[model samples]
Target: MPAHDLGPTDPAVTVPEITASVPTGPPPAWAVLQRRLFDELDGAWRTFRDRYTEPDGRLRFRGTIDDRDGADDFYEAFFNWPALYRLGGADDLLPAVKLHWEAVTRQLTELGLFHHEFERGYDWFHQGEALLMFYGICAADPADQRFRERAIRFAEQYLPQSPTGNYAPRIKAIRAPHNGSDGPRPGLGPQWDDRFGGEQSTMRPYGLPLHDVPGVAEWNDLADEELAVRMGHHMRDRLGRGDTAVNLAVTALVVNAWLYDHDPRLASWVREYVDAWRERSHAAGAMPDNVGLSGTVGEYHDGRWFGGHYGWTWPHGVHSVGAAALVGAISAGIVEGDADRLDLARRPLDQVWEQRRTGLPSDPEATRRPGWAHTLGPGDGPPVNTLPTRLGLDGWFDHQPAQVAYWTWLWWFGMRQEDRARLEALRDHSGYDWTVVHAFRDKEEAGHEPPWLAYLDGVNPDYPEQALRMALAQVAHRTALMAADEKGADGKRTHETGADDGLDLHKWQRLNPVVTEVLTQLTTGAPQTLYNGGLPLARVRYDDLDAARPGLPPDVAALVEHLDANGTTVELVNLGSSRTRRLRLLAGGFGEHLITTVHWNAAGGAYPGDSRDHHLPAGDEVARSAPVQDNTIHLTLPPGRRIRIRLDMRLNARQFAHHTSPTTSRRP
Candidate 1:
C-alpha cells in the first residue's frame, strides 16, 4: 500500500551513489552541537575525491552530482569547495580546485565558454557564473600559487582582450562571449552573428509578467540608437527587454568575484547592468523580475516583466534575491561604493521586510503556488520551496538547494534590522539543510525506512515532508527526463509528462522550453539534487554552538552575527553613551571556533586576505590560528564605538568525538 522504498537503500529505488564514510557516532551533546565546518568541508572534498574521480583525474557525471561535466555542475561544485587553505590553512582543496579548473577548460569550445552541451558551444550566463565561482574559490587563498595562477588564467580567457567572444564589445553586455559549436558560419568570424534558432541565446531573458502592470510605461526610446551603435543586441528583433533570476543572480556573482580579485571592469559592467535595472525599479517602484534594455520598465504590451523558467514568478524572486543581497553586501560599508547600488538591491528586500511586517514574504495573492512565492522565510525555517526554482540557467537543466541557499544566505547579509533579525533566527537553513538532513539521517541511523515516506502518506502530520518531497521530486523528474528522450514532430529535442508526475518520453515539447521544463518536474518521480546546503548539516551542529559573545561590557551588545565563508562576522552595537575601550568576547562553545585566530574585518580588505596575522593595536596576531588556551578574544572599539570582527578558523588536530564535558546527554 505504501508508495515504494520509503526507507534508505531499497534495492528498488534508484539514487545517485553517495559514497562517503558516514561518521556514525552518537557524539557528545556538546560535540554534536559543534560543526567542524572545516572538517565537513574537507570531508566534502574527500567525498568528491573518492567518489567522483577516475585515476586519470577525469571527473564523471551522467546526470548525477560530482559529474562536474557541465557548467551547472562546475558552478555548484565550486560554490562548496576550499574552506581551509583559502580561509584558514588546510590547503587540501587547492589541488582539487586546480585540477577541476583545468578540466573545465577542456569543455570550452570556440565560444571560449562552458555549458552543459559542449557541442552547443556556449551558455552565456552559466559561462560567467562558473567563471566567477572558480575565481572566488581560487582567490580565497592568495597564498596558493596554483589557485592564484588558475584564477588569472580563467580571467584572461573569460575577459579576453581578443574580439572573438559572444560578450558585447562594450562595457555592459549581459551575453557571455560565446560562439556556436561549429565555431562560426563561413563568412563571419568568432563573434556571434545575426542568426535565429541555432545555438544563439536570446538576451533580456527576464521573468515575464503574466498580467498587465497598469501605471508602468515603457520609457526607453533608444532602440534606433542601440541598433545604430550595435552593442549586445542579439541578432533578433527587440521591441522590449528584461532580466531573469539566472542572469541577475549570476551577474551578481560575477561582479562580486571580479571585485574579490580587484578587477574593476567586470564589476563595473555588473554595475552598469544593475544601473539599467535600477532605473526600471525606480519607475515601477516594485522591482519587476525583468525590464527593458534601455533601463526602462513597463514596456512590453504583454506584461511588466519577461518570461522564462524564472518567469516573473517564484524562480524570478528566488534568483533576484542574490543580486539584491550583493547591493547591500557591497554597501555593508566593507567596500567603497555608492550607497545607491545597495539601495537598488535592497528594493526587493525592503518589499520582503514590509511583507514580513504584515504577513510572510509569500505572495498571499499568488494563485499558482503560495510556497514558491515567498523569497526566503528564516534560516530557522524550512527550505523556501513555495515552488521549485529552476535552472535552465544550466544548459542540460536541473535544480538544487545549494544554489537557493547561496543566494538566500548572501541576501541575509543585506537584510535591514528587522529583516536581518528574522533571517538570523533561521540561520541554519532549516528547510534545505537542517530539515531534510535531519529527516534523512535520523531515520537512517535508527534503521528505519525513509521517515519521510510516513509523512508523505499523511501518517506523520508534523513532519516537513512537503518540502522534502518537493526537493526529491525535483531530482527525480530531472533524472526521468534525462533517461527519457523526447523528439518533436520535426525531431527537435523534446519531453513528455508522466502520469506519476515523472518525466515521460513522449509529450510534445512546449513552445516555450522553459514552460516544458517546469511541467516535467511538477509531473515527475522521486527528484534529484546535486548538492544540498543541508547535506553537510548532518556533520554540522544542530544547536547554536557558540552562545552570544559573552562578557561584553554592559554598554556593548552583540548586535549582528553570522558565519561567512571563512569565519564568524560579528557586529557589536554600543547602546550606552560612553565607549568601552576594549570588549572581551567569551569565545567558547564554537566547535572549532574557540581555537581560531581573530582579525578585525574592517582591517582586512576581504576574507582570506583578512585572515593573516593581525597586530594593529588590536588582538595578538598568531602566525596561524590555534586552540585557544583561554576562550576569549579582546577587541579595541573603533572611533564610532561600533566594530565588526572575523574569527577566522584554521585546521588543527582532527576534532575529537567529545568536545564538551561528557555528562550532557545527546539530543538534536
Candidate 2:
C-alpha cells in the first residue's frame, strides 16, 4: 500500500470560486426579529456536553437518555455538530470533538460500530446510528479508517439473509433480529450474560448499567422485566413500523450508510421503505407518527410513555421527524435521483408549517375522536408509555429552531423559484429569516458568559484560573481530519485540503453524504419560527412564502456587485444601524479552502488585508479554525452605510487541474 498523494496538473475545468447576494437590507421589525437563537442553542449544547460528556468525550449521563451506552455521544455528535459548529463560529473544541470521535469507534461493541445496549451488549435497534456516525466521518474525514472497515463487514450483518448467509440484494425489507431473524454474517459476538437471554427485550433501560452485559450485583429488578414486557409488546406491534417518526429516523440512519458506500441490498430496502413512507404520508394528508407494515396507521403507545411530555406528541419529536426526513430526502435524492420521494417530502413539510401536525389522519370511522380534536398518533397509542413526556407533557411544546432552519436553508440551495414561493407563507410564521442564527456561526460575538465551567467547579468551586485552563482546553489542539479522495499524479494539482490548493461548493457538496460540512456552517436565518414538528431540513415549500425575509440587519444594506473571476465583490451599507459594533455576512454556502484573503473597505482596502477586515488565509494555522471550515466573512461595517468589500479566493484549482467533471470525467 502506498501513501495518498495530493497533486494538481490541469486547471482549466475547475468551476471557479464565485458567490453573491442580491441588493438587500434588514426589514422592519414586523418583517423579522433578531433573536439570538444560535447563542441560546449553543449554550444548551455546551451545557449538555459539560453535563453529560466526559472530559474524554464519551457520554456520562448515568441513567438518562439511551446514552447508557457510548453510542449516545456519536448520535449527538452526528446530529448536533452542524448547529454547534455554527454557534461556536465553526471554531469547535477540536480536541474534544476528535477525542470523542475516536472514543466512539474504540468502544463500538461486537455488533460493529454501534455501542452495546445499556442492559444488553447488542441490539439492532441501535445499529443504524453507528453506521451514520462512522460514514459521516468517512465523508468528512475520509483519511481515517478506524471503524470504516469494521462498518463494511456489517453489510451482511443485518441483511434479510437465509441461514446459509446468502447476502444479496432482494425485494424485501430486513426484519429486526429480535424476531428470530438471523443471518450467517459471522456468528453473533459474545453473549456476555443472560441479558440477551431472549431477543424480545433488547431495548431495556439502565439496569445493570447496560443492556449488553448485566451486572451481578444488579438485583434482578423484576419490575424492569415488567416494563420490558410492556415496551417489547408495544414495539413488537410496531417492528419497523414505517410510519412513526422514530421509525422514520431509524430508516434515515440506514439510508445514510448506503450513501457512503452503496450496498445494493441496503439500497433496495431503503428505496422500498421510502416509497412506502411517501405513499402513506400522501394518502393520509400528513406524516404519520406510527404506521403498520401495510402502510396503514397503527396504534400509538401512550401506555408505554407512562405519561411523559416526550415521544412523537412533543415538539422535539416533530423537529426530529423533520430533521430525519430532511436528511433522508436530500441524501436519497442525490444518491438515487429520488424525485418522487423528494416531492413527497415537501408535501408533509407544508402541513408542518401551516397545520402544525404530522400524524396522518386516523380513518374518520375507524377510531372515535371529536371533530375538533385531532389524532396525535395511529390507533390511539399503546396502553403503556415509554418516555418522561407522558408523565409531564401538557399544552403545546416548541423546541429550538436551529434544526428546522438548518435543513431549510440547505434546501434553498437546491430549490426552484416557484417552489421557493411556497415558502413565502412561512416568512413570519415564527420571525426567522434563516440568516441570524446561521450567520453567527460565521461571526464573532463577544461578551457572552460560559457557565459550563461552573459544572467543573461545584465539586469544591475551583478558582477562575482553573476555569481559564478549562476554557483553554476547549480550544482545538489538532488540525482538521482532511483526506484526499485521490492523490495527485503526473504533476496534477493536489486536493489535500490542509495544504490548500482549494475545493469549491460544488466539489465540497460532492464529497459528503448528507449536507456537506461547508454547507452546514452556511445555515443562517430568521424565519417566522425555527420550530418544526419533525424532519431534518423541512422538505416543503410554502407557495406564498415571503422572499424579502433574510433581509439585511436593521442598520445595514448590501449589494452583490460581482461573482465571476472578479473574486466575490459586494457592497455593504449600514442602513445606519452602526452603533458601531460588528458586521457579519450570512455565508453558510461559501468555500473554506477556496478563500485566500478577504478585504473590506472599512479597512481602507489595505494589502494582505486588515485585522478589521477579518481576512483569514487558507490552510494556515489561524486559517484552519473549524469556524472558517464552516463559513463566515466578518468585518467592521463603517458608520456611513457603504463600501465595496473584495474577497480573493483560490478557486477550485486542484480539482480541475487534477480531476475532471462529469462532462469531462467519468463517474460510475
lDDT of each: 0.32, 0.32
lDDT of 2 by residue, 550-658 (tens): 1233344333333333245555444443343233342312111144456542332222445675644222111111112112344344344344555554332111110
How many clashes in each structure? 37, 96
Question: How do the predictions measure up, each by TM-score?
Answer: 0.43, 0.43
Any runs in candidate 2 off by more than 4 Å, and if so which? 1-70, 73-99, 105-136, 150-245, 250-269, 291-317, 337-340, 353-410, 431-668
Q: After superposition, how far is residue 138 of candidate 2 from its true place, in Å?
A: 1.9
Model 2 poorest ten-residue lDDT run: 538-547
Q: Let me know the TM-score candidate 1 reaches against the reference structure.
A: 0.43
